[model samples]
Target: MKPLCLSLLIPAVLFAGATVYNAPAGVEQDKLFQVKVAGQPSFVYSLPVGGMTYFSYTSFARRADIEITVARPVETVAIRPTSYGIRPVINGNVITFRLDRTAQISVEINGDIKHPLLLFANPPESAPPKPGPSGIHYFGAGQVHNVGRITVTSGQLVYIAGGAIVRGSIFMDQARGVHILGRGVLDGSLYKKGESRMIEVNRSSDVDIEGIIVTNSKHWTVPITASDKVTLHNVKLVSDNDWDDGVDVVGSTNVTVDQCFIRTKDDCVAVKAGVQYFTKFNAQRDVSNVVIKRSVLWNGAWGNGLEIGFETRAASIRGVRFLDNDLIHVEGPEGTFSIHNGDRAVISDVIYDNCRVEDSKGLLVDFKILKSRYSKDAERGQIRNIVFRRIRVDQAEMPSILQGFDATHQVGGVVFEDVKTGGRKWTSLADAGIKATHTENVSFK
Candidate 1:
């Protein structure tokens, strides 16, 4: 429990196939963690979380070693999303680990959850956007811009260069083929509660958002509603506030959220079929074909990690997939993977495949067809054909339930396949402590 004071300077080594970005001018560095990737300084941005949380990101074509110098002597070192099994070599105040592929992990020194450091080892990006366009809005590096609520339309590219910080929100309505790219930071701390969403996509199509850090979102971080063909790739959202849901795919279709890091106060990723979306346009009310894959998520104190509805007002909500993601910390009152079908929707064909949980304080699975504060229909709904495959948990023994309002609004055709909790593979329903009252064909395989 003693603080270790060491020189901040370490000889920089130019390791092949690695790129470490420096902090922008006037951006404060993390006092607790000085991270070096491939022997180069990876600027760790410190933010006030529970007390403080540090974040550092680097890109690698193949592999790299991450070295961290801590301010305090560590008794225990835990690198989590424990399904990765990343065991670090700790020597005094230095911790070292190797990453072979793209990963986002929490480094907890002596099991300190409140002050953990988040490391994002990312894959190499595609070629930078070619410099030739009329619809290009660029913010250069080492600068801070205050552009509040920038609007975009068709065939536009909004690029935020590395080491740039922008205090604004990207609002797109009735847009098509718009891309918001590059490695920068979008800080929304200036926006008060209910003022704005960091990236608001309403009535848009063919939109792509890639490689940016969204911090302190006033409302939902990225809310996609009445949109189609949208993709969110390698975006990091680190904002914990009231009602600050990470990625709310509401009434959207053909959307893919890939390889993102979301540590927020509300649901990390939620799918729904009802929302008012924006001011001018009429919103879509049926949701389908949404995929969220290969992301690292943490839900803090408010909602679920991966959730569907309570706002399921549409007639059909189907074809939603959550694949190969990691939920590191889910501390909420609801289920980590839940379906709260409050309205009159037939929610079906949902799949959670190869998901991992490092530390969870919520239900593993909850599929209920009932009413809540967000419901609109007087009659209840049903959940059908839900599959949870290869789920791995490394923490507390969470409970699960599949109940309904009555026999008319029951849960049906659910399968729990290859789920392991605390190193024990579930062979029976008792191993997972699931209660299926009005459920049908619930099986463990």
Candidate 2:
């Protein structure tokens, strides 16, 4: 969108009259021509942020990857690709770029991004966190001034204190019996609009993230893949950006998310499994034994809490519970608490207990089961054994909806208990909290 300026020069000369013109000199070396969008040329910057190098090209060009390494460890550095006569690719601490032609480039080093890059606020590896008089460590130290990708490897009792800001993904891979305890913080405020992921927990087991504050992440706040026995307690996940979610647990088992505060633009908590035709990573592996309790939600720009199976086919989601949680500021212009098998998975034994609602404009719970588009299991099972008990609502405008789009997959055993009314009541199909068709054995208590 921005206009660019190209340098004017004379022809190269040799032997008074014979011409010997080579490549462009100086900034022209790094200067790339015709790298324009629409009609104007744009500039891409190859810079370092949070201990990581990024090769960013302007005008939405196909990404060029390269690596650059810093000789000395400086507190902060900003690398711009336009100045270096090249586009950069960021790999860890290294940044690599390519010059447009054989030319000279100018590089200017500046201090880090005009702010306090808090490194590590938590305790170091050598020091163990001390417990309180009650034998519980409520908080850990704070870390700042680090950038890019952060890898937290195998260790015991790794505690991160609150107020620690992380600009990249927190990679906890292959860690056994890890505990991220205390009232700490993991801040990813910088990547609030970028393409980087906030946290990635892979191949980890028996891990616990409790009593922490994680905010301003772009994608999922906490993502669990191939992990087992994971627990999230009293953690707060909040973001003001679009596509921000509380937690996304995929292909994980025996996971529990309880006593947490979630506020974002996406699902408060979403669970899923892998399918053969519709899966991304491994296939035919379903998620099980997931529980959510005592949590509070502010609002997701889309929906509040959800269980989606758009990719997973014939995937059975079982033993899931949403207990004693609060859903605040839910907008059901469509519906809230959406759980649809998407014509595939058999979502079974899901329970919602003691859920209090402050204000909602959508259905309290939505479960629509149908045949799988990708699976030949035409006899796909129903959304079975789903129950909602002791749900107290201070306000709501929409009735709960339950509908089986087709006859092959029917809804079964749906119950609503102790439903309390709140807010100014309106009457419409859009106003009922429960709307169902071909839903069987459904009851409201």
Q: After superposition, how far is residue 226 of candidate 2 from its true place, in Å?
A: 2.7
The models' CA-based lDDT, in order, is 0.81, 0.53
lDDT string, candidate 1, 31-147, tens digits: 789887767777777665522222233344467778889999988998877778888999999999887877777888888888888777656556666555778888766566789
Candidate 1 has which clashing residue pairs, if any? Answer: none
Q: Given candidate 1, what's the lDDT at residue 264?
A: 94
TM-scores vs. true structure, each candidate = 0.92, 0.62
Clashes of 2: 50
Give the clash count for model 1: 0
lDDT of 2 by residue, 252-307 (tens): 88999976767666677777655322124553456789998866665544755655
- Give the winner by lDDT: 1
Q: TM-score for model 2?
A: 0.62
